[model samples]
Target: MTRHKLGFWILTALVVGNMVGSGIFMLPRSLSEAASPAGVILAWLATGLGVLMLALVFGSLAVRKPELSGGPQIYAKELFREGSHGSRLAGFMSTWGYWVGNIAGFVAVITTFASYLSTFFPVLTSDKVWVDTGILTLKAGNVLTFIVCSLLLWGTHAICMKGMNGAGRLNFIATATKVVGFALFIIIALFAFQKSNIGPFLAPRTNDSGETLSLLSQVNAAAVGTLWAFIGVESAMVFAARARRKQDIRRATIAGLLISIVLYVGISILTMGLLTQHQLMASQNPLVDGITAVIGPIGGKLLAALGLISLLGSTIGWVLLSAEVPFQAAKLGVFLPSFSKENGKGMPKTSLWISNAVGQVLLLSTISGSISAAFDFIIYIATLAYLVPYLIASLYHIKLIWTGETFTTRKERVTEGMIAGLAALYSLWVIIAGTADLKTFLLGIVLIVSGILFYPLLFKKGKVRGTSN
Candidate 1:
C-alpha cells in the first residue's frame, strides 16, 4: 500500500503555519525594542531578500537532487566526498543541531501561546511571587504559565499520535482561521490607524544599558528577531519524501514564503500605525494591543483569540516538523536508529516522544521570568541552532555550483552562485549579530555542542550512512 502523500495545499499550509507562528503576534514588541521604524523596515527588507535566497536554494536543490529529503541539513552530506567520514559527520551534526533547534522552536510557540492566553487569564502572565528561597523564588504566574505551555505541547502530541492526517486537518483548520482573522484585523487597522503614532522613522534607540544605538546597530539587533518570523520556510522541504510531487516541494516553499512575508510585513508595519513605539516595546501581545488601541478592549480579546489560534496551528506544525526531522535523518542513517522506529499509524512515535520530552524541559524555563523573556530566550537558542544548518547549506550550495555539479550553463552557475553567496553572508551576519550577547551566545553554544556527546550514537549500531569503520 502506498502512503498518503501531502499535496501542495497541505504542504503549503504546513510551511506557512510553522513560519507564521508566535513570532507574528509578539514580534512587534521585539522589533520595536530592537530598532527604530527605519531600522526595522530595513531589517525586514534584508531578511526577506536573504531568506528568499535560502528558499531558492532549497527549491533548486530539491529539484536537482530529487532523492535528497529532510531539508538542507541532508544536503550537508554532499558538501564532502561521498562515502567519507566528513560527509557522515557533517550530515549527522547538522541534523542533530537542526533537530534540537526544532524542539526549542516548539517550546517558543507554546510559551507564546501561554502569553496570548494571558490576555483572558491574567494569572498566566502575573508576577505575583508565591514562594521565595535563597536558592529559588517561584512566581505564581510563571508556574501557571508552565502548566499551560506543557499541557498545550502534550495535547498536540496526543493529537499527532492519532496520525498525521488528523493533525494535518486540525492544523489546516487553525491556519485558515488565523488567515481570515488577521485579514480582518488588517482591514480594521487601516481605518483606525493613527499616523502620529509612527514617530521618527530613524530615531536612535537606547539599549538596556542606556547606551544609544547607531542605525547599523539597530538593524543588527532587529535582524535576528525579524528573521525569526521566517525561520520555518523549509518546512515543505523537510518533508519532501511525503510531497505528492518533488517539484511541489519547491513551489510550496516559495508560495508559503511569499504568503508569510506579506502577512508579517502587513501586521508588523500596520501595528506601528496603530500604536506608538514606546507602547509597542512594552506590550507583551503587541498585535492585541495594537488592535485594542484601534477598536477597543473587545478588539484586544479578538486578536488574542487569533493569536491563540495561530499559535495552536504553529505548535502542531512545528511539533510534526521537529519529529519528522529526526525520523527522516534516522532513515537516512545519520541519526540514531531508535528515532526511526514507527508506530502502527506510520508515525515516528519514539522520535515524537523524545522531541516533546526535551521541549517539556524547555517549558520549565518559563517558570522564573516574564513570558516574553522566556520566549526570546528559547527563540534565540533555536535561531542560533537553526543558522548552523543554514550556513552549512549555503556553503554546500556554493560548493555545488563551484564543482559544476547541478547546472549546465554558465548563466545558471552564475545565478546560483549569487544566490548562494548572498544566503551564506546573511547566515554569517545573523550568527555574528545574534550572538553579540555573550551569555545567550554561550548558552546556545552549550546546547549545540552538547550534541557531540550523542555523536557516538550515530555509529553505535554501525549503521550510519557512509560509515566505513
Candidate 2:
C-alpha cells in the first residue's frame, strides 16, 4: 500500500481537477444572472484571497502537524484538548458536514455532465413528459437525465474501487486536457474581444422580478457562486495520508490554487466579451455559446465534449475525496468504526458505498425539476455544508497561533495570524451575506444538526481512541 502513494503532480492535479469541474463550464450563465461585470470581478477577487488564505492555513498545518491526516475534521478534533467532549464533537460534526458537502459536489458535477450530454441528445433536457398519473408525474427528459447521473455516479464508484492510482491517472489526464482547452479558448476570446459585449461594467443588474439590485447586493449575490468554484482547495489535505511527502501537500495546494484561479477568472470574465449578458444568461451551456460566437458552430460541439470529459474526471476525484473523509475519520475514532474498513486494494469499500448511496438520493431528488434547476439547488446545500468546516478550520488556525501551539517563531506567527484572520472573516461573510436564501441556509443547518443522532454510536463500542470522539 505504501508503494502506491501519490506524488506532487497527482496531488496538485486532485486539487486542480476537483476544482475546475462543471462549475467553470457553467459559470458564465450563473454569474450573468447574479452580477454585472464589475460585481463579478469583485466576487472572484474576494473568493480568491479568501480561499488562498485557507490553502495557506491547510499547508501550514500539514507541516506543523503531520499527524493530522484527514482534512478539517481531524484538525478541528485533534487540535483541542485530548479525550474531551468538545474536541470529540468538533471532529464528528466537521466530518459529517464535510462528508455530506463532498457528496453534494459529486452530484453537482454529474448533473452538469448530463446537461452537457444534452448537446449530443437534446431530449435529456426536454420538458416533455413520458409518464403521468393522477398521483404522480414524471418528465421523460428529467428521468433520463436522472438515470444518466446515477449511472455516472456508480460508474465512477467502480473505477475508484479499483484503487486510487488508476483513478488518479485518469483524472490527471482529463485535468490537463481541460486546462489546455480553457487556455486555448481564453486566447481565442482575446483576439475577438469586444468592449461593448461587456456592457456597462459597473451597471446594476436587475433581478428576474424586475427589481434592480444595487452594487453591494450584486456582489453579495455573486460571491457564493464564485467561492463554489474553488471548493476543492483542500483536496491535498484531505488525502494527506496518501501523499508521498508532507511538504508536497503544501506545494500541490498552492500550485493548484494559482492555476485554477487563473482559469476561473479568465474563462468567466473573458467570455463576457464574447456574448451579451442576456445571451449568456439564456444559454444552457454558456462556454459552448462563448466558443461558438468566437469561432463558429464547431466550437460549440468541441466545448460540449470538453465539458463532459471535465465533469467525468471531476466525478472520480470527488468520489475519492468524499469517501476518504469518513474512512479517515473512522480510523481516527471520530466516526463509526465500520467506515474504516478497506478492501484488498486499500480503497475504503464501506465508506464508498455509504457516500455514493447518499449521492444517489440527492440525484433522485432532482427528478421533479429541470436538470439546470437541480444543479442550482444541490449547489446551495453543498455550499452551505462546506462553509461550516471552512469556518472551523480557519478559526482553529488562529487559535493555534494565539496559543503558540503549532509553531513558536514570532515572525511566522504574525503572517499566519493575518492569513487565518482574513480566512475566518471571509468564511463568515459568505455564510451571513452571500447566501442565496435563508430557507436553504436553514436547511443546511438542519443537515449538520442532524448528525447528533449518530454521535452516540461512536462511543457505543468504545472504538474511538485518545479523545472525545
Candidate 3:
C-alpha cells in the first residue's frame, strides 16, 4: 500500500466520527426507560473510565512497538507466537471475529443514517400500503432505505478505492460535523432547560426488572448501557499504521475519549433539564427532538437534517474503517492473502469489496423491518464486533505487563501493562453485561467457530500477507 501522510487529527476525526454516531442520537431514550436518570449518569461514568483504561492500554502498546499492525492481531501475534497451533488459531479467530463485527457495524450505521433521513422526509419512512405480504413485508421506506444504503455503501467503497487520503479528508469533515452538532445540541439544551425537568433528576431507577436483587448489580447494568455508547472508543487504534506521530496516537486516544464523555454527560444533563422524564422517555430522538421543540419546526427540521449529515459522516468513517480491517489482518498475516491486496493507488481493493459485500448482506436481511429496528440490529451487531478486538488487545497488553516483557524502555513497562490488563478485564465485564442476549451470545459463538474453520483454508495457500512495519 502507498504510504499516505494521514495525520493524527484526521485519524482522531475518524475516531470521533465513529464513536458519536446514531447511538447518542437515539440510544438515550431507550436507556432512560431501562434505567433511572441517575443510573444513566452512572453508566456514563463507568463506561468512560473503562474506555480510558482501554485507551491507556493501547497507548502503552503503541509506544512500545510502533511497528505492529492490526491492533488486536498485532497484540495476539506478539504475545502468542510461542504457543501451539490451537493458540494461533484462537488469535486468527479473534482477528476475523473483529472483522465480522465491524462489517456488521458498517451496515448498522448506514441503516441508521437511512432512518434519520426518513425523519425529515416521511414519505421515505412510511409503510407500503400496497405490499400486503406474508411474514415479511416491504414498505416504501424499505425501498428508499435500501436505495439510500446501497448508495452510501458504494460511495464509501469508491472512496476507499481512491486511497486513505480521500477517506481521511472526508473523515475529518464528518468528525467536525459530529463535534459541532453535539456541542450545538449541548449549548442550546443547557439554556433552554426548565427548572421542573431538572428536579428529582436523580430518580434512582433500575436497568432491568428481572429482580436485580442488589444496588451494585443495577449500577453495573447502567454502566453497561453507557459502555455501549462508547463502543467505538478504540476505532483509531485499528489504523495504527496510518498515524503520523507516535505521541499523536496517545493524544488522539485520550482527547477523543474525553470529548465523547463530556458530550455524553453534558447532553444527558441538558436533555433532562430541558425535557421531563416523561418527555425524554417518550421521545425517539430526544436530543434532536428537544432541540426542535426549543428551536421551533424550522430549527427542529434543520437539526434533524444536520443529524442526517452527522449520521452519514459517521457511517462513512466506519465503512472505510471496517473495509480496512480484513485487509489489515491480511497484511499482518493473520487472515487470507486475498484481503491484503492493494490497487495502483495503494487502496485495499479486495478487502474493501469484501467489507461492502458483508454490509450489503446485513442490509438486505434487516431492510424489511422498520428503519429504526433495522438500524438498531445493525449497530448491536457492530458493537459486538468492536468488543472482541478491544478484549484481545487489552488482554495482550495486560499479559505482557504481568509477565514483565522487556519490550519498551521509554515508560515503566509493568505500570503500563497492568493498566492495560485491568482495562481488558473491565472491557470483558462490560461486554458480558451490556450484550447479554441469547441471539448476541449465539452470534459471538458462531463468529468464533466460523473464523477457526476458515482461517486454516487461507493458511494452506502459503501466500499469507505479513504486516507492514
Worst 10 residues of 2 by lDDT: 460-469
CA lDDT of every candidate: 0.87, 0.87, 0.71
Model 1 Cα lDDT, one tens digit per residue, 295-367: 7999899889888988999999999999999888888777788998888888889999999999998888898
Put down candidate 3 lDDT per residue, 62-83, tens digits, no spaces. Answer: 7766766555545666566543
lDDT for predicted candidate 1 compared with the true structure: 0.87
Considering lDDT, where higher is better, how would the candidates rank from best to worst? 1, 2, 3
What's each prediction's TM-score?
Answer: 0.96, 0.96, 0.91
Q: Relative to the unseen true structure, what is the C-alpha lDDT of residue 125 in candidate 1, on a scale of 0 to 100?
A: 67
Candidate 1 regions exceeding 4 Å error are 1-4, 466-469
- Judge candidate 2 at residue 159 and give its lDDT: 99
lDDT of 2 by residue, 267-307 (tens): 89999999997898888788888888888889888989988
Superposition error at 147 for model 1 (Å): 1.0
**TM-score, candidate number 2:** 0.96
Show the lowest summed lDDT stretch of 10 residues, model 1: 460-469
RMSD of each: 1.9, 1.8, 2.7
